[model samples]
Target: MPRKRTPDAHDRILDAAGGLFDRYGVHAVGMQQIIDDLGCGKQLLYREFASKDKLVVAYLERCTQDWDRTFARALAAAATPEEQLVEVVRAVQTMVPGTRGCSLRNTHAEFPDPEHPAHQVSLEHFKAVREQLRELARRTSAADPDRLGDRIMLIIDGVYASGATLGATGTAEEAVALARDVIRIETSLPVAESEIPADVR
Candidate 1:
C-alpha cells in the first residue's frame, strides 16, 4: 500500500517557495532551491506541485490571500468607510518595510507576457482590488467615489514601491498623511485633530 502523505506538504512547499520568491523574485529562484530550502525529496516537491509554473501560480494566489487579509483588517479598523480607505494605505505602509515590495507586482514585472499565468493572476488581482476599493469609495460622501478610489489605489501602489526602495525615508512616511489629506479634501470632511501628527499639528 502507498504511504499517506502529510497534510501540510502542499502548504510547506508553498511557504518555502513564497519566501524565496518574495526575497529574490520568481525568476531568480529555481525548483532545486525550493527543495533545498524545504529539505524535502525531489519527488515530494514534484508530487505537490507538478511544475514551476504551477508552484508560481500557487504562490501568487497566496499573495492575493495576504492582500485580502490586509483589506479585512483595514475594513475592521475604521469606523467609517472614508477612514477605511486611509487604513488600507496605512496597513500597506506598515507591511512593505524590509521586503522586496509587493510579491505580485514583482512577479508581474518578471513575467511581462500577458499570456503568462503569473501575469494573468496578478492582473486579475489588480482588477479585483481596484473594484473593491471603488465599492468602498462609493459608501463615502465623496462627490466622485470612483476618482477617490483611483487616488487611493495610486497611493497604495506608490507606498509599496517607495517602501521597498526607501524603507522609511521615502514616500512611505508620507503615505498616511497624504491619504488622510486626500480623504479630507475629497470628502469635504475635516480631519480630527487627534489624527494629525504632533509635529504637523
Candidate 2:
C-alpha cells in the first residue's frame, strides 16, 4: 500500500519549490532539484504534485497571493487614491531589489505558449493588477484615470525589469520619485504648504 501523505507534505513541497523557482526561473529548475532541496522521496513529491507543470501552477498561484498582499499593504499604507497608487510603486520597488524580479513576470516569460496554464495564470494576474490600479486611479483627481493607471503600471513594470537587471542603483532607485512626479502631474494636485514660499503664505 502507498504510504499516507502528511498533512503538510503538499505545503512543504510547494514552499521548497517556490524558493527554488524564485532563485532560478521555473524552467531552469526541475523536479529532481526540488526533491533534493526538499529531501523528500520522489514518490512523495509526485503524489503531491502530479507533474512539474502542476507544481509550477501551484507556485504561481501562491505568487498571485503574494501580490494580493502587496496590494493590500499599499492600500493600508496610504489614505488617498493618489498616495495608494504611489504606494503600489513603492511596494514593488521595495520588493524588487536583491531578487529575480517578479515571479509571475519571470514565469510568464518562461512559458510563452498562451494556452499553457502558467501563461494563462500570468495573464490573469496582469489583468487583475491592471484593474485594481484602474480602480484606484478612478478615485483620484487625475484627468484620465485609465491613462494614469496605465502609466503607474508601466512604472511598476519598469521597476521590476530594471531592479532584476540592474539592481537597486539603476532606474529602480528613481521609481518612487518618478511615481510622485507622475501623480502630481496627472492629478494636477496642489503643492504642499511646505513647498509654498513663506512670503506667499
Candidate 3:
C-alpha cells in the first residue's frame, strides 16, 4: 500500500515555489527548480499542483492572502479614512525594505497575456487594492476620488518599480511621504506632523 502523504507537503511545495518565483520570476522558475529546491520528486509536486499554471496561481493566491493580513493589521489602528490611507502607504513601506519587489507585479510583467491565470489573478488583486484606495479617497472627501485613487496607485507602482534599484537609498520612505502629501493636498487639510505615524514620519 502507498504511504499517506502529509498535508504539509502542499505547503512545502508552495514555500519553495514562492521563494524561487520571487527571486527569479514565474516563467523563469520551472517545476524542476522547485522540485530540486524542495528535494521532492516530480510526482509529489504534481500531486499538490496539477500543472505549472496551477502552482503559479497558488503562489499568487498566497501572496494575496499575505497582503490582506498585512493591510488589515495596518488599518486596525487607523481611526479615520485619511489615516487609513497613510497606513496603507506605511504598510507598503514596511514591507518593501527587505523584499526584492512586488511578486504580483513581477508575475504580471513576466506573463503579459491577459488570458493567463496568473495574470488574471494579478489583475484582480490590483483592482481590489485600487478600489480600496478609491473608497478611502471618497471617505476623505477628495474632489475626485477616482483621480486621487489613481495617483495613489501610481505612487505604489513607483515604489515597487524603484524598490529594486533604490530601496536601500530611502526610496520607499520618500514614496510614503509623497503619498501623505498627496492625501493632504487633495483633502485640503493641514495635516500636522504629529498626525503622521512614527514609522512613516
Candidate 4:
C-alpha cells in the first residue's frame, strides 16, 4: 500500500491544485495534470486528496477563505458603508481582463450536481455575497436595500460575464463605471431615512 502523504505533501498538492484550478479552471484540469504540475506521484496525490471531487472542494474552500479575508479587510478600512461598496467594486477591477473569471463561478459553471459539496459552497458564497451587497446598498441608499442589492447583483453578474468576454477592451473601467452608476441611483432613491439599515460595511 502507498504510504500516507504528510501534511506538507497535502498542502503542496492543494497549492498546485488551486493554481491549476484558477488558471486552467476546475473542469479543464485533471488529476494527471495536477500530478505533473506538482511533480508529486499519483499515490501522493490520492493520499492527500482522496478523489478529484474532494480536491475540488478543498480548492474552493481555500478560495473562500482567501476571499473572505480579503473582502473583510478591505471593508474594514472604509469609513462608511457606501465607501466600502465602492472600494470593493474597485478591488474587483484588478481581476478584470485576461481570463476575467470568478473562482466560484468558474468552478460551478459546468456543475450538474448541486449536491456536491463544492457546489453547495458555491451557492453559499453566492448568497453571502448577495446579502453583503444588499446590506451595503441599503446603507448607501434611502430605498429598499433588498431591491438595490438584487439589481447590483444582476449588474455584478453582467460585469463578470463582460470581464470574461471583454479581454483587454477596458472592461475593468467599464465595470467600475456601471457599479458607480448603481450607487448613484441608489442614493437618489426615495425612502424613509429610517428605512436604511446600519452599516455592516
Evaluation by lDDT, superior candidate among 2 and 4: 2
lDDT of 3: 0.83
lDDT of 3 at 33: 88
Q: For model 1, name the residue pairs that clash.
A: none
Candidate 2 lDDT by residue in tens digits, 7-100: 6999999899988888988889989999999999999999988899988998899888988998999999999999998788888866662478
Query: In order, what lDDT does every prediction score?
Result: 0.88, 0.88, 0.83, 0.74
lDDT of 3 by residue, 94-156 (tens): 555236688888888888899999999999999998998897788887898888888888988
Instruction: Say what the RMSD of model 2 is.
Output: 2.8
- The local distance difference test score of model 1 is 0.88
Instruction: Write down the lDDT that model 4 would get.
Output: 0.74
Model 1 worst lDDT run, 10 consecutive residues: 164-173
On lDDT, the leading prediction is 1
Compare the candidates by TM-score and give the number of the best one. 1
How would you encode candidate 4's per-residue C-alpha lDDT over 1-201 as one tens digit per residue? 867669898889998888888787788899999999989899888888889999998888777777677678758868877667666665664543247377788777767588888889888888898898887777775477787777767766766677777752366566556666666677773433553566731
Better of 1 and 4 by TM-score: 1
Better of 3 and 4 by TM-score: 3
Q: After superposition, how far is residue 55 of candidate 1 from its true place, in Å?
A: 0.2
Off by over 4 Å in 2: 1-7, 169-173, 193-201
Q: Give the TM-score of candidate 2.
A: 0.89
Question: By how many angstroms RMSD does model 4 differ from the true structure?
Answer: 6.9
